[model samples]
Target: MATETPTSGSADGYYDFHDHDDAAHLHALGYQSEFKRDMSPWANFSLGFTYLSPVVGVYTVFAFALATGGPPMIWAFVLAGLGQLMVALIFSEVVAQFPVAGGVYPWARRLWGRKYAWMTGWVYIIALLVTISSVVYGAGPFIASVFGFTPSVDTTIACALGLLVLATIINFMGTSVLAKAAIIGFTAELVGALVVGAWLLIAHREQSITVLFDTFGTEGDSGSYLPAFAAAALIGVYQYYGFEACGDVAEEVKDPGRLIPKAMRQTIYIGGAAATFVCLALVLSVTDIGAVVSGEVTDPVSAVLEEAFGTVGARAVLVIVLLSFLSCAMSLQAAASRLLYSYGRDDMIMGSSLLKKFSPTRHIPPYALVVSAIVPAIIVIGSRVSENAITKIISFATLGMYLGFQMVILAALRARLKGWVPSGKYTLGAWGLPVNIIALVYGVIAMVNMAWPRTPDAAWYDNWIVALSGVIVVAVGLVYMAIHPLHDRSTAPYDDAIPKK
Candidate 1:
């Protein structure tokens, strides 16, 4: 057992200023520090919040949801929000027990073993990288809208690549700058959600509250609203994710055992409410619902905003949405780079040494950051070659992330069944078992709902891309694991002094 140090500042007086308590906790987990602990509690919250950016998530999928299911699709946001809250509870428990960086990878490793951990990390890192591309590509149209330019394929690709490069530069500046930028993003998103949502609901409301229940007569020949409504639920399912980014940066957060768990729950609470509210406001504010559903007005959000606030006011809101997109990409890139660095630290990836190398002066992982930036840029460029590239990439990101999340939850639940008690300060006690089960159930349902083929009229690949892409990612991981099996390289036994109970 490792002895607990006194709660007072260290004899050298440095503990009062530096995060010596967090350092001791890391030592107890058998890890040596390579990153600076500069993230405050709010900064940690901001990381998860910005990654779950309501503006970005809602704006990206708004038109699709509206067109597919009309105003009734807002219910999907409510349902998915409740389901995701269950998952967030499970995540908070696990992260509290093992507040290590790389999020699901280390948590799964601690609960299960090395092989499972490798695959979990593999899926998660790929999801995050592809998420960066998805977010950047989603932002392209809005960028064009703000600048009063038509968004051609070439212009969209150029804008995405430029945003990626800028975000990469900010990430290279180190955690302090990254945390500050995240706080700015959180503020902008929160303000936009409240101010814009309230303005739309108050000044330009066209639809009644009853409209939320109506499917706008788009149930088609089937006459049942369930299918279209469920299909539209994809927007909410994808929006609720990105909260796990908090755990990915656990090593840099102060007193993460307590702070990170709180951050996760708060991220869900604030992000879910904001997204639901914005969706409700936008749905009610539509000047012409028939036009939106019929595709006569392609961009309902901009159209509604321009009708209520004029083109100048709509462009002003777009500026904030653009910032949300940029911040979201930055947060995703930061999480992906940290995950790479964590895998490299364990010699689990291809370029372990180089990827794990931290800059001495800047205190950032340069190579990992560079790779994170470059790969997403390449994916954006690939959009020029394949017409369906962005759609497929977004599907991969959503499915892959949910898969990784469930793997960790399942491992934790299995460990619990075997008497692996949570010994962290933030344990759920009697509530842990039930919450874990509900979270697992929710994850499986969401995964199936997302992967099920919805587009019958489209080509075969377009309809089945999510399922197909997921299988490919898993097969590749399995093949790599078979070729270069990981040996059981356990860390020093965890010291009990870190956990409160």
Candidate 2:
């Protein structure tokens, strides 16, 4: 491993590498290349694509988006895809400059300072863990459906626990296994989505493309469409995020500076297109759009699948969906463990030494993987209290991730304004600042839309739950930071300079 030393490079151009090795580039960013660089560009892209699983995202949120905003909600996929593509562009540049593990956390640390990174990591870690639980828990019913069992809370919890354990074991096998699993998951999801989507569009089309513009007046008492559309945007917002996971395992990917950017953007492009196609197919296949919009028909995705393909075919598809969920949970676990290892390696959190310890032979952080699994397992266990517990836990996840991404973006913008240009292989050139500004604006608006209190008639806390949960988490982090002061504890170099090419 190379010692932490700043490599000599021009401040205004692409960073120069000592050789073709990614380790030399990583060392320049102030860290040893600990993980084996075995992941190819395709594997890296697969990790992000699986993490941003179209099947899982579309199936999970389809009913809600349709019910809340009517058929027109399909446009949210397009809006979110374009907006998040901008964010992905910003991430590519940052990761190209400082392609360190922990993705947003390390990016923010280098671009701004430790405190900002600490907060960003804290929020993102929470979100990732919760999202793991959400994905597995969400997969429970599919598991039951595939196996021909009733999906009670107990069965669901049991299935979730089983999945959690399976994914954890896979993570313990190290990066190669994880990468291969992601690729398999990506293949299954893409193939399933394509076949199912084509089938639905061809033989099961119940509505025309013009129905996509029909709102069905789901705007409710507001007498306006924008609010409903904004609320419905969560479908796309949630689907587009897993792209950042590509950078989370920077040390494991070869030529991360250049390849990771391409991987990130590809995750968005390919993943977004897959999501939109699947969503459009499902939307067009719905037999009764008004019934769905008026809350009479729930679970439209499952309904359409079963109706179009019958029980046997739907179950086969459920098998694919379950695989997507498994891969998604595994990818999320990998990302969380890497971030924890990054923090631990930097001595930025409590139990730093333990979390930083990698499996000697496997070259993976065993302790950090365990920590990642344990937290989400506990969150899954919380389902005993109420099914809604999982809902509440996950409600803040998308918001937390967006918040973390914006922190990095905001940090980069701050550094840029202070005359720090991105010296990465993937710099946006003259368009960097304009792109950065627009990304930030779009992120803030999406966050507000997500955190906005849309459930007016429900209890106040329920209505304000998303915003309230985010505030509470941040406040808790603030209190913990004040007492422990983990911000200034990192020994890792926090400079923004990259090696000159």
Candidate 3:
């Protein structure tokens, strides 16, 4: 166990080196300190919050949710919030024990074995890269609107690339700069959400709170509204992730076993509340709920913002939103690069030497960061090949992440059943088994709902894109593993992978 030392403050609120104790902990875990441990508790929490940015999540998916499930879609936030909160709990306990960089990958590696970890990381890293493209591409319209350009497909793509570049540059500056930017983004986003949601509810609410139960007949030709509600749950599914970002840089955080768990929980709780509040405000303030349900108001979130705050104020809010998007992308980029670094360190992938290289001054993986940026840039550029390419691919982002998360949850459950007790700064104790079971069940159900084909009139591929994407990604990963046998080469510890009876 690592003993906590007194934290000494610096000018930027980051702590000085007070804990060789943390370094000893890393050594005990079979790793050395290569990254700077400069992240304060607030910075750690901010990174998780920015990764799970409510503004980015709510603004990006609000219209779709409203159109797909009408005013009742707001309840999806409640369902997802509770469900993901359970996932956060499961993750917190695991991360408290592992506190390893690469989040799910290392957790899965220790909980199961390198083979399971490889698949989990492969699915997760691809999902994170695609999510970067999806988010920045989603931000294109907001960036265009802020710059007075008409929001079109072309302009959105171009602006998204530009934002991606900016985020990449920020990430290259090292952990301190990234932490500061995340703190700023978190403050702006949380404050802006509260202020905007309160204003809309108090000054511009056009419907009663009772409207939440009204579906406005979004069931379409379906027999039950449950189908439509399930489809609309995408918004909440997308919103609640990114909390795992906190654990992805475990080495860069001081006293991580204790801090990272709290950060993850804080992210799910605070980020989920912000998302639900904002979604509720937008739902209540919709000028025409029927129109939104009918798809006549395709951009209901912007409509509410524009109508309530007018053009100037809405543009200002766009600036804040742009910051949130940029912060979210940067955080994702950081997470991806750290996972790559962890893989490299373990010789779990090709080009292990280069991928594992850390900058002496920055204490960051420059090569891995570059790879992260380049892959997402390729994903964005490739997305333009079809008009709906990014849209179809983005559908897989949430589902892919859910799959990765559930893999860890399942591994943890397997470990528990094998008598693996969580011994860390934080543990659920008597509640661990029940919490783990519920989290896994909820995750699997959510995965099914997310991947279910809902669009009957669409192409077979389009309707099944989410599940198809997961299958393709997993298939490719399995092929690579079979050919290369990389997991067998991993140098990481796996004492937690107890043999089956």
RMSD of each: 4.7, 3.7, 4.9
Arranged by TM-score with the best first, the candidates are 2, 3, 1
lDDT of 3: 0.84
TM-score of each: 0.93, 0.95, 0.94
lDDT of each: 0.82, 0.85, 0.84
In the range 25-143, model 3's lDDT, one tens digit per residue, is 67766778688888999999999999999989988888878888887887888888888888888788777766778899989888888899999999999999999999899998788
Across 1-501, the per-residue lDDT of candidate 1 in tens digits comes to 111122323221112323437777666566787888899999999989999999888988888889889998888877888878778777777676567788888777777777778889899888888899999998898889899999888999999998898899889899999999999999889877999999999999998999888788778889998888877887888898878899999989878777787888898888999999999999999888888888888788888888888989989988998888888999999899988888878777678889889997778889999999988888898878876565667767988999999998888888788766665556677787888898899889988988899889988977888998899899999988887764245342322212223
Order the numbered candidates by lDDT, best leading: 2, 3, 1
lDDT of 1: 0.82
Using lDDT, give the best candidate's number. 2
TM-score of 3: 0.94
Candidate 3 — which pairs collide? none
Evaluate model 2: give its lDDT: 0.85
Give the residue spans of candidate 2 off by over 4 A: 1-14, 386-391, 495-501
Better of 1 and 3 by lDDT: 3
Q: Where is model 1 poorest over a 10-residue stretch in terms of lDDT?
A: 1-10
